[model samples]
Target: MNLKATIFGLLVFFISGQFALAQSTEIEKEITELSKKKWQWMADKNADSLAVLFHDKAKFVHMGGTWGKDREVDIIRSGGIHYKNADVHEVMVEVLNENTVILWNRITLLAVVGSNEVTNPFMVTEVYVKEDGNWKLADLTFSKLMTRD
Candidate 1:
């Protein structure tokens, strides 16, 4: 190709690439919002909505060393992990090439389980994957802060 033609082609390619990246960022943000809403739904014991946000291969690791997808679903069903009051202070998103994203955040959870009241701050991480144009949680992990007496 001629020099001028080559330059124009390169410019167009660069612009389109940038546009695609911007669009991907926006889409990732939307997915993050959806994931947070799903957590809220879980806290509210809205099993139907929460189920929709989890992929078929979703796995969860509790801070207490519990691991099991079926048990996680059961916990949600029985309100075992209900969050009466919680706050997500910060969310950091790492995009893994358009279809996979990793989310990390710090959260403060204050709630009652049965008759016992628990309040703790924790760091949470979750992996989300896009399937058929929707993002769903594929893996989840949480760790609680420990304090010395």
Candidate 2:
């Protein structure tokens, strides 16, 4: 499909509530729940919980910069960028392989950065890998959106 058509399709998918009501597979439900909890963890600044969820070499990408797991944990712990809230409007889960999955969340985030409180729409991509029977976040990247509700 062309880029415009793809975007439109996604836009329609998000706007419709049918997907939310549809029954998900067992693994899909698991990952969706985990993703929801991740947002709560960030809002609560529970770095300890996040530390356990993030992979040892996980990478975090933000508007300002990109960093690894340690820095992300420290940033949350120190309130460098307080993730006050993430209003998740829609989400898509795509299982890549036996051990990998990709989750896309359309969210409007309320955060505090250097004493400045800001809210922005973002397309957040989270990649998860199953290791030792647990899912670890391998990557988290936030892409600011030009469109806003």
Candidate 3:
């Protein structure tokens, strides 16, 4: 009886672990696709799409300053900083849990700020959370890369 019980417990555990792994993979793929869409939206200055993706309390950290969702949206809408393009060099997504994920990417951005075009390499970190069965951007931070691309 004892041997049978142990075997049953081990089987349950193995099945649970496999299910979790599969779920994580699905989440990673979802977030990766979202991240790519987000970059394209930024380049296109689609504030409406971004407004939907970003949480109300989302925070954005940039080389110049940090701000909340409203401010970031306003900046994009007003063309304060225009994202012309983002040349992504590499990207990675990590599932922190069932409802949270983090994405890291190395990218070179071509942007226009105050009539000046600038291209800079950066390592961007983005955090996302699932809310109401949808993934929303929670936080974004950009670290300027010293190495030129």
Candidate 4:
């Protein structure tokens, strides 16, 4: 009787652990897809698409602190940070929960200003949350690695 009970308990525990792992993996994959969609929107310079990805009260810290959506729009419109070319690499995502995610990645930026080509490397951290059945970026932070010196 003792042996049978122990075997059944162990089997139940193993199955429960596997179920939890599968759920976590699914959440991770969903968050990763959301991050990819955001990057693609940026690359395409689709302001509307990018806007939808961000929560209305989203905060973006360019290289400093807290830039609002209006400021972001102005920067985009005035060509303050135009991307002639760019690439994202080495992206890693950490899931906080089913609705929250944190991601870090390295991005290379290339911009053209009337024949002058500028290339820069940046490290970025982004946070996203599932709100009202859609994923939206809650915060974005960046460090200008190549421009430090």
Task: Specify the highest-TM-score model's number.
Answer: 3
Model 1 lDDT per residue over 1-149, tens place: 89999999999999999998897798678767876886688678887776777787788877566565666777778867776765788788888877888888678877666667788887778888889988888888877867311
C-alpha root-mean-square deviation, candidate 2: 10.8
In candidate 4, list every pair of residues with a backbone clash.
none
For all predicted structures, in order, the TM-scores are 0.86, 0.83, 0.95, 0.78
Q: Which stretches of candidate 2 lie over 4 Å from their true place?
A: 1-24
Candidate that scores best on lDDT:
3
Order of candidates by TM-score, top first? Answer: 3, 1, 2, 4
Q: Write the per-residue lDDT of candidate 2 for residues 46-79, one digit (tens) a residue.
A: 9999999999999999999999999999999999
Poorest stretch of ten by lDDT in candidate 4: 77-86
Global Cα lDDT for candidate 4 = 0.74
Query: How accurate locally is residue 7 in candidate 3, as Cα lDDT from 0 to 100?
Result: 100
Higher-lDDT candidate among 3 and 4?
3
Residue 113 Cα positional deviation in candidate 1, in Å, after optimal superposition: 3.5
**Candidate 4 per-residue C-alpha lDDT over 51-108 given as tens digits, one digit per residue, 9 for 90 to 100:** 7777878888864357877666555545566655557776888878778888887878
Candidate 2, residue 98: CA error in Å? 2.8
- Report every candidate's CA lDDT: 0.77, 0.92, 0.95, 0.74
How much is 91 displaced in model 4, in angstroms? 1.1
Cα lDDT over the full model 3: 0.95
